[model samples]
Target: MTKESTPNDVTLAEPIEQEVEAHSEDNKVSEQEKKKFEKREKERKHLVSKLAQGNMDHLLTRVASVLNHYQETRNSDITLQTRYWEVFQSDIYNGSVIDPKDMYKLERLTSIARARAKIQNEFKMFLADEEVQVSRRSRQETEKEIQLATKPEIPLISMYCDESGKTGNFAIVGSLWVINKARQTQVRDHFSKWKTEKGLSAKDEFHFTEMKKHQLDLYKEFFDEVIKNSDALGFKAVVVDKTKIKRPIDEIIMDLHYQVVHQGIEHEVSNGRLALPRIVNFFKDEEDGQEALYETKLKQHLHSQFRLAFDDQLTLDLFNSVPSFQNVYIQMADLYTGCISRVLNHPKQGEGNHKDHFAEYVLELLRLDLGAKNDQSQDFAMVHFFE
Candidate 1:
């Protein structure tokens, strides 16, 4: 059982050579020697055949044991010579005794171990690279998800409108579309700051005609800011010639409101700007006379006809209501109508008046013309004069 003291202590290769030498006997060779030689050759061939077929599992187990032993003695971070000297010099194989032949076996095993480790290292590198690639792909996908979640959904469009002049006279309805809530708040805050700083009454309306020189200057500053950021705003104006329509005053006003709404929707649709939910319209809701009744009728008309008019069912309803002076945009709409009515109603009367060409200032601010309608209009705003 002891490896060093075993009867088969001779090397496996040496015994075969010794057997061939012993069977040679005399130079002529005896029959017994021939028979023994033939028998040993048959035994060697049978052992080889058995190993190739049935002992393969046993061979594989030996190969696995050698590979594991080699790995235990070797570290990739160190060279084979450094690893052998550092790690394996004092180690014994399965606690067995060693001989001269065992040294030869160890040298051969070391060569096999080096070859096995090289292939295994390649496999480890492949797996590591694949893991890094997977991590990078996951990071990119997570970044895209974050972008989708954080981006804004949709912006809003606010239409603030007012009518100037009587229903019987040359009336004008002016509307301004504030782009988004931020821009809308920006305008309101600017107006509020100026009004408070100037000590203006909260109840005192923002009527442009009644504004003094200093007030006009304030108005000019606000209008200039809006004009500078005009791309973020849309303005519309419609002047009605009462002489051309024989309808009642209320009826005429309702019709003009309808025209303005229609024009606004058409312009928006043609411009491919229908991403928002609804068009918010805050009109000068006068509660006097039949104005409320006419408004009710107008609402019903728009509700029934909006989709039919513009061929869009996806757009939200037009919010038409009366906003107080507290709403700065409604005040802006009021200012626009008042200025527009002055030019259209009294073209010759303001000829000698020093404040005669105030309409020119209005035009410069709003960039509105009463007649032009372009499908692919380069201008961001529109002014329609309806006779």
Candidate 2:
């Protein structure tokens, strides 16, 4: 058919059809791209969530197992299994994207498992060795008893003393006795009576002036009682921190030693009286001004004290083959003291309130319990391990 050729119609028809087609194709392509992107984003989120869940579960399991093993064996050398160690290294320690093959190295896995097993076996051996030694020591004591006419009782005392301030405050002196049943009862009764008579209550204070007075009163009362009972009970060496003494440190040490001798002679308990000292002193220098410096010093001091007090070498070699005591002596020079000092030095920085919060946060971190929520979560995780 011969159509009438209108100039406007011929110009518009083909291009409009083509333009509509192109626009539709572009929309379709855009929709497809959007779908792909959404799918990938969803997958990424899902994978992250799954990995996080797995990491949490693994960490909980491993920590619980390690803790339980430590409790059962009383060994600090307990280790995690290979698979668990890999999980820790990958998820918790490294915080990296881990591949499937990286998760399983046969040799590494075997080594970790063997290490854990060896640690467990070694701990068991240690316990057995200790028991054997204890039995042998008992036998030796029995053998030695036959040579002596009468056995002399070992005199021991446990003292817990705390000082308030380095220079300005007084010291709180708390003493307890570890003795025969009869003596414990007597001492307990005496303490009760004294508490009632003096109306003494255990209240902690920060003001040096007030603390000093309170400590002085407590010391006086304690000294009087000890003096009165000196004839019946022999005295032992004092346990005290050598920091922040009103008197010179050396003088305090010597005085305590002399008191032990005096008490021994008065009671006529033994011929050779020796002062077995337990002293707590920190390494002080100019570098100990920063927080990190203080932390390092604190750790070093605590470790040294723990080794000296509870480790085998010091107890066995220096103390005439005496077994080490399990209980460790903890110094009272904690972050609370630091806070107080900071408050005293700079009252303008809201130091009084903030310092305590900072100290508490540091303590929480040390305990691996960030807050109450973390503590509860940890307990739940621990329960899972047992199951």
Best by TM-score: 1
In model 2, the clashing pairs are none
- RMSD to truth, every model: 38.2, 24.6
Q: Write the per-residue lDDT of candidate 2 for residues 1-387, one digit (tens) a residue.
A: 998979989888989999999999999999999997687655433322322111223332343333222222212221233224433454433433555676564225355444443333432211323453345245454344333213222233322112222333221121112222224335535644665677654232222222343354453444355445433332222223344345664344333332332232222223322233222111111122335544344344445544754352211111000001111111112222332333333334444343444434423322323222221111101100000
Clashes of each: 1, 0
Model 1 clash pairs are: 370-385
As a whole number from 0 to 100, the lDDT of residue 148 in candidate 1 is 36
lDDT per residue as tens, model 1, 60-144: 2233222222332222212222233322333533323566655654435455444434433422211113443345245455454
- Which TM-score value belongs to model 1? 0.51
Q: How does each model score on TM-score?
A: 0.51, 0.24
Residue 111, model 1: lDDT of: 59
Judged by lDDT against the true structure, how good is candidate 1?
0.52
